[model samples]
Structures are given as C-alpha cells and as structure tokens.
Target: MTAQKKCPVCGKPAEIEFRPFCSKRCADVDLGRWFNESYVVPEPIDPETVIADDGEGDETIH
Candidate 1:
C-alpha cells in the first residue's frame, strides 16, 4: 500500500513531480505570494491596553 500526501497549498493530493505541491502552477503561485508577503498568518491584537516592555523604556543610569 502507498501512503498519500496532501498538497501544501490547496490540501489536495500531491503530485509526484511536485512532491509537496499538487502542481507546478500551485507551487509557483505560493512562491510568488510568499515573495510578495501577501500570504500571512492572521494574528489577533488588542488595541485597548498597551504593554510597557517593548524595549522603549526610559532607563536612568547612575
């Protein structure tokens, strides 16, 4: 029995030539998006309260 692999982009079955990707077009599209920084993982941010320690603290040196 052969193991099945899913495409990294569309979650479809990956083709042998593309290995992790289903097709050359999909792989290229993903590469282009990554190069352009258009594909990003969504992160949640809170706008109300600000945390102090983001390296902008005023230090009093003796």
Candidate 2:
C-alpha cells in the first residue's frame, strides 16, 4: 500500500477530486504559481545528447 500525503497548501487531507491538492482553488493556485514561475521541476538534459525529432519537429526518444 502507498502512503497518503496531506495537502501542503492548506494542511487539509487530500481528496481525489483535487489529487495532491485539497480543492480546485488550491489546484488552480498551484497551476497559476507554476505559470508564474513559482514552481519549477528540475529535469536534467544532456547538452551533448540530441533529442530525436519527428517529422513535425516534435522531439521524442525512440
């Protein structure tokens, strides 16, 4: 079984409706914060490696 986490924003129990967030407001806040650069995901991309691009110029690793 997996452990459940509490909502960090409101300190309330998380529900499935909002997932890791507690409510739609919280979810929207998170999204807005992300859009405003408040949150960032640290993903490492190798400069030497080239990503495969599809014909449409969309990159995907095969």
The C-alpha local distance difference test score for the whole of candidate 1 amounts to: 0.79
Q: Taking the tens digit of each residue's C-alpha lDDT, what string does model 2 give over 1-62? A: 65666776787877777889888888888788778784565565766565544457635655
Model 1's C-alpha root-mean-square deviation from the true structure amounts to 6.9
> TM-score, each model?
0.52, 0.50
Best by TM-score: 1
Q: Clashes in model 1: which pairs?
A: none
Give stretches of model 1 more than 4 Å off: 38-62
For residues 1-62, could you state the per-residue lDDT of candidate 1 as single tens digits? Answer: 65779988898999989978999988997899887785564555656444545766677853
Residue pairs in collision within model 2 = none
Clashes of each: 0, 0
